[model samples]
Target chain A: MNGVHDMGGMDGFGRIEPERDEPVFHAPWEGRVMAMMRAMGCVGGWNLDMFRNARESQPPSFYLTASYYKSWEKTLETLLLERGLVMEEEIVASRSFSGSTVAGQPLRAEDVSKALKRQSYERSTSAAALFKVGDGVRTRNIHLPTHTRLPRYARGRRGTIERVHGCHVFPDSSAVGAGDDPQWLYTVVFDGSELWGTDDDPSLKVSVEAFEPYLEAL
Target chain B: MTLRVRALETVLLEKGLIDPAVLDLIVEAYETRIGPRNGAKVVARAWLDPDFKRALLEDATAAVSSLGHVGEIGDHLIAVENLPTLHNMVVCTLCSCYPTDLLGLPPVWYKSAPYRSRVVRNARGVLAEFGVNLPPEMEIRVWDSTAETRFLVLPMRPAGTEGFDVDALASLVTRDSMIGTGLPKLPEVGP
Candidate 1:
């Protein structure tokens, strides 16, 4: 699905220049590591059921596997290893795609791979709780990285707690691959005028599911 | 989960736990398949039936479930019908928790931070961006969907759309129509 960013082509308001250079570079084996980490993170964070169901179906194109990363090196490595097309150690030592060096030593394929995986896991697990379901609350407009169900328009807006949908998946900054941590999920309800002002129709009301961090006690 | 979603995916790829190919599939499935067709049905029905439309304005959930969509938000699903005297739009305000069961996934703009933040503050101006020019006399009701009660917009039945069946009427109810920015038009009025 095209996001707001993807709508750049629709009108003059959203246009952005495409990057001249490619965005990622990693070996095939290294790429598999990243794919696995993401899948695990998503399953653990947002929809574990989706991950399990996808695995059972064994759909060739499921995003839970390593073959789909864009970097050629990662794709090749995952294919060779998962399909047994190549030995494990052969690609580990190769450094053809090295973009930088750390600690005065060229970063090994394994070291970079490990760092990426660690980062993914850390993001899915962190978030502080400030409120709960059934509590009268208001939204805060502060922006941060990690998954947050709160919509932008409702910030600082008052609403009532509808339900504490047990901790489900968080979609804050981390859900999108940013470095931020996870947040709790809650459903909030708002009056028509609270959002649309006095001109709003009296007959209608809006309800939405949001994360805990995006809200505060009213 | 835009930037962080990507960043996390990158980290996972480096970890060798998941396959990047699978991630693409997940993204594709969500983007292409799981979206707002559910709510389009409601918008279509309201555009076609007067009795059902009346029922929706009075009690939206029952009216919608009559067509077979048990909303997933909570037990009490609220359907805000937009009328001539009043116009209603929905926004997550915090994120994009739309009535997927009735509407499917929200459109890209519906989930935007700009749309989410500004619509409630300057709804008239925002609607204008979508080419929705409303008279000042028309009340603009914006429903903030939070909590367990999900929301779907019941757009007004367009003029010149008489005699259309539910399916045909639904075909005219695009996602935007339910968002309160656009209205379903009769076949002759469409470009």
Candidate 2:
């Protein structure tokens, strides 16, 4: 979507100062927000990609100014509003007049650990990969208005395939309520000069995982 | 912000859409049970055992899962090792996609605009701010976690730790070291 969230090379933001002894959450609300997001995932209507799109699709002002959990909170709100899980007035009133119609069992406290377990996105495919290791390729200059893994900086740039990560769910389609639509994933490496105009450091390289749909034969 | 979150929670709870007990459990797990200490243990085991290191470098998912360190956002894991002539770091340019199961929630700096926008373009400069001054000749590889594949930088062990056990070595494996922003703690500095 070319949103401000796709921040790669565009600069002018100041230096990074790592906090000393940083806590898991800055406030109690942050933790609750995180837990709420995870718990909402158990509701089963939307995928992870949809949650991310809701957050990234926000206005630049909100995306930039909102803290991490604040973004999650907004994303949760956006998802709930869109899914009709809760009404706007209900949120404002901080209570529910009518019950939600969203289908899915609530995540129980006993099943929290199981719900938190990692789920594999890698899906088997009968098709062969278009590119292999050491193959030269160029990233397709795709600028979709939907969620995509292809960063703007590497779009249309030349790179070498480093590794084949097997087929995985394509975010572009998944974000829009499409099915798995898994594609071959590869680690494509580009020289620093290839990504940026010039490289001050001689030995600098950048790499991104490119799906088959985001690549073209060079 | 707090009130908004509380309000949202209130609505969800009143609507019977989510369980409050589940929320508390999730929060408690991340707060007390899971974190970078899990990644540190993995790194320490890899440093001590060559076969495990090779397995980790080959297939990090199975390796970490074998150690029972498994959770969401960590299903597809990749471990990039740092050497004398080579260094690797990770960033999700589009968003804050980190290995939450291994490192708990990402640090604020990782999700901030400055780190996300600059790390790929000026990793050396970014690392410098993190007190990591790599040699000019050494190659720097910046990994953008643009996909589901999460990354963990297996930082090189510090010198003069010949007899250190896994626990002792894990102490030196700081969270930043695994993120490739800083090297492991030196022996004299202590864990």
Candidate 3:
């Protein structure tokens, strides 16, 4: 879905403001939320794509009200509830039901470190890359309702293959219900003139990692 | 932020969804450990050793892991060099996918709508807003981190720091420099 989170080109938000000596998190809860999100990953089913999709699924109004970590908190709640790990009333009442959640591994303190290191998507396979470095390719104009790694601005745009990042799990299929299907990943370079037109700085070049299915021979 | 998260915690604790001790551990890890300094060390090491830099650019996961800074978010990392001719920037247009293990959490601005929306289209303008006014002739390359390979911008070694040790060079790698929104500061000029 073309959610509001896909804010690549559309403007009017504000300037990119960087604070001097910015802290890792703003509030204490933000820290807890970050920890919870990481801990919740131990529950075992959802991938990063699903987590991202949930954050993006938020309605514009509520999404706007949330600071970056607030958005993470909201989605974490929704995902837990939907996964049957927590109940809506459980959250409301601030207590667990007798059989509130299904059997799952509780994230012990030690497991936190292990959990952080686990779940690597990088895999080795015998498949060879379809496109090599320096090959020119065009991004397929794919607009999917499901989660995707392809950004909107780069779709249908032409770019030169900068590097081939071996075969990695394809998120478009994996993010949904599909199994882990490895695809050739290429870092494609797009000229500033092509992406932004003549008015912007011509010296700028944008490069993005394009999946195999999202690209065609140019 | 404290009130809302505390309230949420109260609910979760009552509901038996979270363990307080475990929560504390996670907080400690993110707050005290696991952050940009790890990335800084990696960048600093690369500056000190060309072999490590080559290995990092070729396979960031192994090279970074050799330094003992690794995590799930950085299952695979692609360290892009910000050379004299090329200036690299990283962003996840689909979502805010960052190397949390290296940089801790992303700064607020990186996750903001303005930066996410405009960086892909107007990187020069966006960099300007971030106070990175690059020369027009210098090539700017924006790495849209739209895949599993997390990006870390290996900023160019600042000039006139020849005698500095790895620790001193490590101090120069800022959070923004790793993100490519800003450059590592030049060593302080002396009288």
Per-residue lDDT of candidate 3, residues B51-77 (tens digit): 999999988878888774443345678
Q: Model 2 over residues A1-218: C-alpha lDDT tens digits? A: 89999999988889897999999999999999998888888884889899888999999998999888888888998898898888889888989989779766787888888777657789999999999999999999998988998999999999999999999999999999898998999999999989887735668899999999999989
Scanning candidate 2 chain B in windows of ten residues, the lowest lDDT window is B66-75
Point out the higher-scoring one by TM-score: 1 or 2.
Answer: 2
Estimated TM-score per prediction? 0.48, 0.97, 0.93
> Between candidates 2 and 3, which one is better according to TM-score?
2
Better of 2 and 3 by DockQ: 2
Q: What TM-scores result for chain A when each predicted structure is judged separately against the true chain A?
A: 0.40, 0.97, 0.92
Once fitted onto the true fold, the runs of candidate 3 whose alpha carbons sit more than 4 angstroms away are: A124-127, B1-17, B68-73
For model 1, the interface Cα RMSD in angstroms equals 12.4
lDDT of 1 by residue, B32-146 (tens): 4434566666667666667877787666656765775533222345677776788887766543556654554355456554566556556676777776788777777666654
Write the residue-wise lDDT of candidate 2 on B11-47 in tens digits. 8898777888889889889889789998899999999
Instruction: Please list the residue runs of candidate 1 whose C-alpha ends up more than 4 Å from where it truly belongs after superposition.
Output: A1-42, A45-218, B1-32, B46-77, B101-105, B147-149, B189-191
Steric clash pairs (candidate 2): none
Model 3 agreement with the true structure over A97-125: per-residue lDDT tens digits: 65435356558877777766635776577
> Best by lDDT, which number?
2
